[model samples]
Target: MIKAKQIVKKFESGTNVLFAVNHVDLIVPKGQFITITGRSGSGKSTLLYQLGLLDKPTSGDIELAGRDVINMSEDERTFYRLSKLGYVFQDYAILPSLTALENVLLPLLMLGLPDADARRMATDAMVRVGLEDKLINYPSQLSGGQQQRVAIARAIAHDPEILFADEPTANLDTETSDMILELFLKLHKEGQTIVMVTHEKDYAEKADRIIELADGKIVRDETLRRN
Candidate 1:
């Protein structure tokens, strides 16, 4: 599903060049749930951003579904991001003013779907995330986990090829975090391709593979088991 080779992301820091992600190569096949775990500032998120096409690497080659992604024009990359990728961040990334259903359907509308189609798809996504009853609730009206579920619903409403989560459980309580992790596991069981960045060891162990990074490099890549 994704191939990245010799990826490097550098930043200028007071006349010094710092590599946030350095010489990393990774491959994620279809339907694999991969967890990237590392300490703070280890570049795990940086690598994920590059792989998810949120940020282009300073130097590297990235291929998604076998098409080279690094050299695409800005518009082309934006189109690909909207059509092929889904993201869930630690903050939930939902608009507070929009209701749960509207939050999910808004992007579908942006993708040019008809209002009826977008509404139906949004409802289905909410159902999949176990949020069907809360569709009309505003963000401020829902619990933290429910809001995050709404975010997840939004991410999958259009059936993106790859679902990327960056520290998805960071802000929730333990029980809520477990619930969220289990939800991701359920989606993975149903053939969703997931790449998640997390710090919790037990949660990270649930994935098909674990990638450990440090100092902008992969220190360990372990397969806990094949799913």
Candidate 2:
């Protein structure tokens, strides 16, 4: 569903150019759950931003579903992202004032979905993430895990072709993190395409494939046995 060739993202600091993401090539097939794992500065998140169209690569090409996204204008990219992609950040990016259901409804409403249809979709998404009962709760009223589930529901409400999660379990405890990972696993089983960036090997192991990064390059790509 996504392909990147010789992707490079660089930043200029004084006279030195830092390659946040060095020359990298990747392909993510439809319905495949992949994880990118590396140390803090290994460019795992940088590569993800490039692939997810959240950031443009300094050089190289990115193709999603066979169309080149690197050349799209900012407005076009925004539309594409809203229509086709979903994201979950390390921090639950939910609004403090919005109810969980309303948070999920925002994107759908942005897509011009009717209020009633949006509500139904949002409710379904919340249920899928085990947050059905927390729909009316505000972010501050929920636990960390519940807050993250609302974020997840918000991301998936539109049935995006692919879901991108960047360090999604970073803020939770061990048990909560496990629950979140299990939720991701459940989504994968339901054929949701996912590309997650995580520092934990244990979480990465749960994915269909794990791509390890080092110095902004892919050092290992392993396909795990799906039991």
Candidate 3:
């Protein structure tokens, strides 16, 4: 449900300009799990950020659910991000001071939902990620996998249309990474729209579609069917 056309992003360092994304065009269909794969400095994260409306392109256009975001006001973009998107990071990005359930409820709180209803939604989301028993646990009390599940729960608590994950398995061991990817696959089966940015090809290959980035451009795009 997202479309980008000839997106370009550049950063300035003193007198030099570095292009983070160069004339990239992409479309993320609804109900599909897509992955963007690239090495460090390949601009995968920049492209994801632009897609999520967290950042704007220097010269390009993006549309979400048929709405052109490049022309939206700042507040409009902010509202859309809060209402339509969820994010997961390699670091988990959970509040250390909050319980898993509470962390999941953070986004609902921002939406001004009643405390009881938010907690219920949070609990349900945590359960969906297989973290129901860890609701009362703090981030430090949980394993890396559990923490990532909490992040996932938080991201989906509001039933966002799209989830953007940046290097989701980078901080975990191989086995834990596998579990996380499996969880992602499960969510996709449940019709969650996801756009993941990862350096791991195995993870990207697991997605329904893979987009490869190099020097800020998409060099390859492939679609696959799972056996």
Error of 1 at 121 (Å): 0.9
Candidate 2: clashing pairs of residues: none
Tens-digit lDDT track for model 1 on 31-72?
999999999999999999999888999999999888899999
Instruction: Give candidate 2 regions above 4 Å deviation.
Output: none
State every prediction's TM-score relative to the real structure.
0.98, 0.98, 0.96
Q: The CA-based lDDT of model 2 is what?
A: 0.93
What TM-score does candidate 2 reach?
Answer: 0.98
Question: Arrange candidates by lDDT, highest first: which order?
Answer: 2, 1, 3
Q: lDDT for each of the candidates?
A: 0.93, 0.93, 0.92
Model 1 scores a TM of 0.98
Q: How far off is residue 160 in model 1, in Å?
A: 1.0
The clash count of every prediction, one per candidate, is 0, 0, 0
**Which digits, one per residue and each the tens of the lDDT, describe model 3 over residues 1-227?**
98999999999999999999999999888988999998899999999999999899999999988888898999999888888899999899999999989999988998889999999999999989998889899999999889998999999999998999999999999999999999999999999999999999989999999999999999889997642
lDDT of 2 by residue, 68-116 (tens): 9999999999999998999999999999989999999999999999999
Looking at candidate 1, what is the lDDT of residue 226? 88
